[model samples]
Target: MKWSEISIHTTNEAIEPISNILHEAGASGVVIEDPFELSKERVDRFGEIYQLNPDDYPDEGVIIKAYIPINSFLGETVEEIKDAINNLILFNIDIGKNSVTISEVNEEEWATAWKKYYNPVKISERFTIVPTWEDYTPVSSDELIIELDPGMAFGTGTHPTTVMCVQALERTVKKGDECIDVGTGTGVLSIAAAMLGSSKVTALDLDEVAVHSAILNIKLNKVNDVVSVAQNNLLDGISEQVDIVVANILAEVILRFTDDVAKVVKPGGYFIASGIIGQKKQQVKEAIEQVDFTIQETLVMEDWVAFIARKN
Candidate 1:
C-alpha cells in the first residue's frame, strides 16, 4: 500500500489545533519535529539513551507530519484540512509559516518513520512517558512510567500541556479519590491519575478514535481496572461529583464548558486545565473564575500555559 505524508511547518502555538486537523482528515499517525528538542536538556538517570540526528529537524519552526492513505479522495481531504487550519485564525491562533507539503512513501517506510522521534523522557519529577517500542528502567523506586502508542491520537502524553496536567495530578490526587480526565487523548492523564492512587478515573473524549486509542493505552499501562474510557463531550450529562477534574484541550473549548466543569467537581476538589496558549491564559482564567473556581496556580512552559483551580 502507498501513503501520502503531509507535513505542515508552523509555530509551536499552532501545533495542537493543526494536529487535530490532520487527525480529523484521516491521518493514520502524527509525528512532531521541533527544533527545541535538540537544545532541550535531558536527565538520563537510568542510563538508557537514544541519539537524535540534526538533519531530521527544522531550523526554526516545528514540523508536524501525518500519514494519509492514498485514495481517490486524498486531494479533497488535504484541501479540507488546509481550510480548517486557515479557519483557526478567527480564533486568534497564530498559524505561523503555515506551509504544507506532501510526498509519497510505501507502507513499510511510513510504519517506521515516526518511531525515530519518540524516546523515553521524564517529563516531571515522578512521571516518565516511554514509548511502547522502547525499553526503559526507572532510576528511582518512586518513579512512575506511562507506556503510550498514541496511534492516531493528537498527543504522546509528553507534550507540555500534558506534562503540566500530570504534574498537577501528582500534587492533587489522593488515595482512593475519584477523578475525571476530559479530552483524555491516549489516556495518558487517566493512567497517571490511576498510578497516583486515584480509586477510579473517568476518561472521556469526543472522538471515537481517541476513545479507542486511550482504552488501548490504559490496558497497556495496566490501569484499565482504575480508568474507564468513554466517548462523550466535555462534562455534558455528568451529574456525579468527582474529587479531581483535569482537561487538556484548546482554550476556546475550555471556555465553552467551564460551567459544566464547575458543576461536576466536588467542593474543595481541583480542576487542572491546560493546552492553552500564552495569549489566552487570562481569558481561560476569567472563565474559570466566572464559574466560582478559585485560581490556585498558573504554570507556563515555553508558549503554553496550564492552570490549577480549586472549587471552594
Candidate 2:
C-alpha cells in the first residue's frame, strides 16, 4: 500500500504540458501548489496545524505530485517520466524557465501510512466526530455525534471553512425549520441541522461520492430519517422554500449562485455563506445586495468570513 510521490517543479507557463505527461504515466492523482498562491500567513497557519516547514518557497512556480501504487511496481515508467522531465527542459523551459526537481519516495514504513493522519475531531460542544475505527460514546449531556472517515472527499469538519459553517448552523438552526445544504460535502452541515432540531434537512452536492458518503454519515449518526442527499447544483431540483440555506463553497461560485440561493429561501429565511477570502468580500457583498438579502451577521476566522444574510 506504499505510494511513490513524483514531484515536478515547473513555472505556471509549463504546468499544463507537464501535467499531461504525469497523467499518461498512470499517476493516480496530481496536486499543484503554487508558491504565489501559498501566502506567508497561510504557510504559517499550515505549519502550526501540520507541523510542516513554512520556509519552502518557489518563485512563480508550482509543485505537481503524482502518486504511484507500490504493489504494481512499474519501474519502467521512471524512464518515460524522466523523458517527459527532459522534454520540459528541452522545449518549454523559457516561457516558464522554471527548473524541474524530481524525487522518489519508497519507504517500507509508509505502507498505507496515511492512517496515522486520521483521528477523531470535535466539531461542536455537543458533537464529536468519530473515525470508523475508533470507539466513542457521547455523554448524556451531548446532543449529537457524527461519525466519518477521511476517504476521498472534503468537508471532514476539520477545515476552517467547514468549522465556520457548522458554527453558523449552530446559531441559525431552530426547531422545525426546513434547511438545505448546497455543495454538501460529507453531508455534515445538513446532518448538523437535523441534529439541531430542524424538522427536515436536504443536502446536495455535484460529486456522486459526496452524495453517497453523506448518506453513510447520516445513517451513522442516526439522522437518516430527517436528513437526505441528492446530486444537484445549488438546489436546482428543489421546489419548495426552506427556512435556512447554507452554502460553504468558494466565493466565485457563491456570486454565480446568488440568485439561485435567494430563490430557494422562504421570505425571511436566512442564508449562511462561507468560503469567501478577504479580498473578495466586497464583490460578494455587492452580489448579496443584488438579491435583496440584508447581511444579518458576519463572522471572521483566520482571514475567512461567513456572511449570515436574511432575505428581505
C-alpha lDDT score of every prediction, in listed order: 0.91, 0.77
> How does candidate 1 score on lDDT?
0.91
- Model 2 stretches with alpha carbons more than 4 Å out: 1-65, 69-76, 83-112, 137-140
TM-score: model 1 vs. ground truth: 0.76
Per-prediction TM-score to the true structure, in the order listed:
0.76, 0.72
Estimate, for each residue in 36-95, the C-alpha lDDT of model 1 and write its tens digit.
988887655434446778898999899999989899999999999999989999999999
lDDT of 2 by residue, 1-312 (tens): 456677666677767777788788887557776776545445332112333233554555677767776555467676677777677767736325344454556655444445455556665556666677777666556546677755567866767677778888888888999999999888878878998999999989999888888888888878999997889977676778899999999999999888888888988999999999988988998899789899988877788988889999
Q: How badly does each model clash, as a count of residue pairs?
A: 0, 0
| Candidate 1 segments exceeding 4 Å error | 4-51, 57-104
- The model with the greatest TM-score is 1
